[model samples]
Structures are given as structure tokens and as C-alpha cells.
Target: MKIGEVSGHASVPVETIRYYEKIGLLLKPDRDASDYRVYGNAHLNRLLFIKRCRNLDMTQDEIRELIRLSENPEADCHEVDALLARHLIHVRDRLSELANLETALQQLQQACSKTGTVEQCGIMGGLSSELGGLSDKDTDQRNHVPGTHKPGSH
Candidate 1:
């Protein structure tokens, strides 16, 4: 099969598949006589695995580590358990941060009673007020949501 075929079967974008290969998450497939990429069942299975991991919000590093561990069928499963536990902790933290964010936005929205002019917009005023600004700790807490791009990523 071709790249497009595999992508459709995996429900992943073609560019994402290429990116996974580039990042060493998915192994590069062999090329046909016309230099077009050729994919097989292995590629399809790997892409599906990657898609499932991504749907679970696992990071590339996490997926890579899981893949490595999977290669050794005889290896102990403790590492997988540990990795999932760590991921769950991160998910919980994000949920807490998101709840706080929702509360903050609600407060900001309540600052204004009704639709008004820009000058009378309480939400804007609250955002601009130095006294109402988020503290450094609050800012840090809000900034680390999952899937946020960090420095040095492509």
C-alpha cells in the first residue's frame, strides 16, 4: 500500500506519518520503483499503535519508550505501569489547572454585567488591571497544559 492508504487506514494525516518517521517514532517504509513510499501491514499496524497512543495524549518521548519496551516481549511490564502512572499524574495536574482557568475566566466574565462599550468592558479592565493580574505561580501553573510546544521542537 501507499502512504495515503496507510494514513487513511490509521486515521492519521500523511504529514503526521512523515513527521513520525522523521522523529524516529515510525520506521521509514521502503520505496517503490518510482521512488514512491510503499507501506505494508507492519507500517499500518505501527501507525495504528501510534494513533492510539496519541489519542491517549501520550507524548512522543513516552510513545518512543513504550515502543522500545514492546520490542522485548520477555521484558517485565513494570516500566509500562510506571510510565502510565506518571502520565496519569500529569493528566490530573492538567485537569486541576484547567478547572482553575475556568474559574478565573468566569470571574473575569462576571466583572461585566451586560454587553457594553469597550471602555466599559469589565473583562478587558480586569485583564488590564495590575492588581487583578495572575501571580507568577498562577501563570506558571496555567502555562504547562499538555501538548504545548516547548523550545527546540520542530
Candidate 2:
């Protein structure tokens, strides 16, 4: 099958497949005479797994670790259990941080009740020095800031 066919069957984008291959997550496919990528059942299965893991919000490092563990079929699954438990803790921490962010936003929003000029706005005041304007600590602890969301690049 061609790249497009594999992508459709796996429900993953072509660019994402290429990226995964580049990052050593997925193996590079064979090329046809025309230099078109030729994918096989293994590629399709790997892509499907990757897509599902991404949907679960798992990180690339986490996926890589999981894949490594999967390769040793006879290995105990205790490592996998520990990995998922750690991931769950991370998710819970993020949820708590997001709740704090939501409260901060709500308080900022409630600072102003009636529509008013910018000079008279409480919202503006909430952002001013007098109001101890928000200087939120960066909640995200990822290596990269994710400034631009390049597809499957993380």
C-alpha cells in the first residue's frame, strides 16, 4: 500500500507519519520505483497505535517507553502499569493547575460589572500595578513551550 492508503487505514496524517519516522518512532517505509512510500501491515498497525496513544494525551517519550516494553513480549507488564500511573498523576496535576487558571480568569472577569470606558474599566484595573496584576507562573513543564503546534512534532 501507498502512504495515503496507510494514512487512511491508520487514521493518521501523512505528515505525522513522516515525522514519526524521522523521530525514530516509526520505521521508514520502503519506496517504490516512483519513490512513493510503500507501507505494509506493520506500518499501519504502528500508526494506529501511535494515533490512539496521542488521543490519550501521552507524550512521545512515554510512547517510546511503551513501545520498548512491548518489544519484549515476555517482560512483566509492571513497568507499563507504573508508566500509566505516572501519566495519570501528571494529568491530575494539570487539571488542578487549570482549575486555578479558571478561577483567576473568573476573578479578573468579575472585576468589572458594567460596561465602561477603558480608563474607567475594572478589568483594566485588574491588569494594572495597583491591583497586583496577574503574573501567573508558567504551568506547563514540557521541554518546549509549544509556541507553534506543528502536527505530531511533539
Candidate 3:
């Protein structure tokens, strides 16, 4: 099969396949007499694996490490477990951060629910106010000014 056919079968762009090859993520395919890149079942399988890893939100470096481990089938599986554990921790942290952001946005939305002039808007008032160096309980302490009540001082 040609590069286009392989990409079509994998449901990925031809440019992506070429980029994977360029980045050494995917092996370069053999060329025909006309120099058209030829692909085989092995390439297709590898592309599918890469796609699955991407869907799992694995980084390129993580995927590279996985591929290396896959090549060495005799290697212990404990390292793979550890890698996944680390990735899970990162995902959990991101989820917690997103939840906090959602809460803040909800509060902002509530502030805007009441009809008023722009200057009288609670959301704008909160944003524009100096807060007198006051900080929210949820605000990161690292950004808080010592003995200050300002919200945006950081």
C-alpha cells in the first residue's frame, strides 16, 4: 500500500504519518521503483498503536518509551506500571485544577446573573476592586501578599 492508503486505513492524515516518520516515531516505508512510499501491515499496526497511545493522552516521549519497552518483550512490566501511575497522577492533578477553575467561573456567572449597568456589575466590581489586599481562601498562598487583602495583587 502507499502512504495515502495507509493513512486512510489508519484514519490519520498523510502529513501526520510523514511527520511521525520524520520524528523517528514511525519507521520510513520502503520506496517503489517510482519512489512512492510503500507501507505494509506492520506500519498499519504501529500507526494504530500510536493512535491509541495519543487517545490516552500519552506524551511523545512516553510513547517512545512504550515503543522501546514493546520491542524488548522480555523486560519486566513493573516499569510500564510506574509510568502509567505517574501519568494518572498528572491527569488527576489536571482534573482538580479544572474543577477549581469551573467553580471560579460559576461564581463569576452568578455575579453576572443580575441585570445592571457595566459599572454596577458584581463581576466587574470584583475584578476591578483592589480588594484592599484581601485574598480568597482558595487563592494560592504563594501569590498572596503578606498582610495584604488584594485579589489581583499577585
Best-fitting candidate, measured by TM-score? 1
> Measured by TM-score, how close is model 3 to the native structure?
0.75
Query: Native-vs-model 2 lDDT?
Result: 0.78
Ranking by TM-score: 1, 2, 3
Candidate 1 deviant stretches above 4 angstroms:
130-154
User: What's every prediction's RMSD, in angstroms?
Assistant: 3.8, 5.0, 8.5
lDDT of each: 0.82, 0.78, 0.78
Clashing pairs in 2: none
Candidate 2 lDDT tens digits, 1-154: 9988887888788899899999988989999999988999998888888888889888888899889999999999999999888777776765676677678678878898688798888777876853363233432334333112223333
- Provide the lowest-lDDT 10-residue window in model 2: 145-154
Name the lDDT value of residue 103 in candidate 2: 83
Local accuracy of candidate 3 as per-residue lDDT tens digits, 22-99: 998899999999999999999999999999988987777778888988998998999899878877776676567677
Name the candidate that leads on lDDT: 1
lDDT of 1: 0.82
Candidate 3, which segments miss by more than 4 Å at Cα?
Answer: 114-154
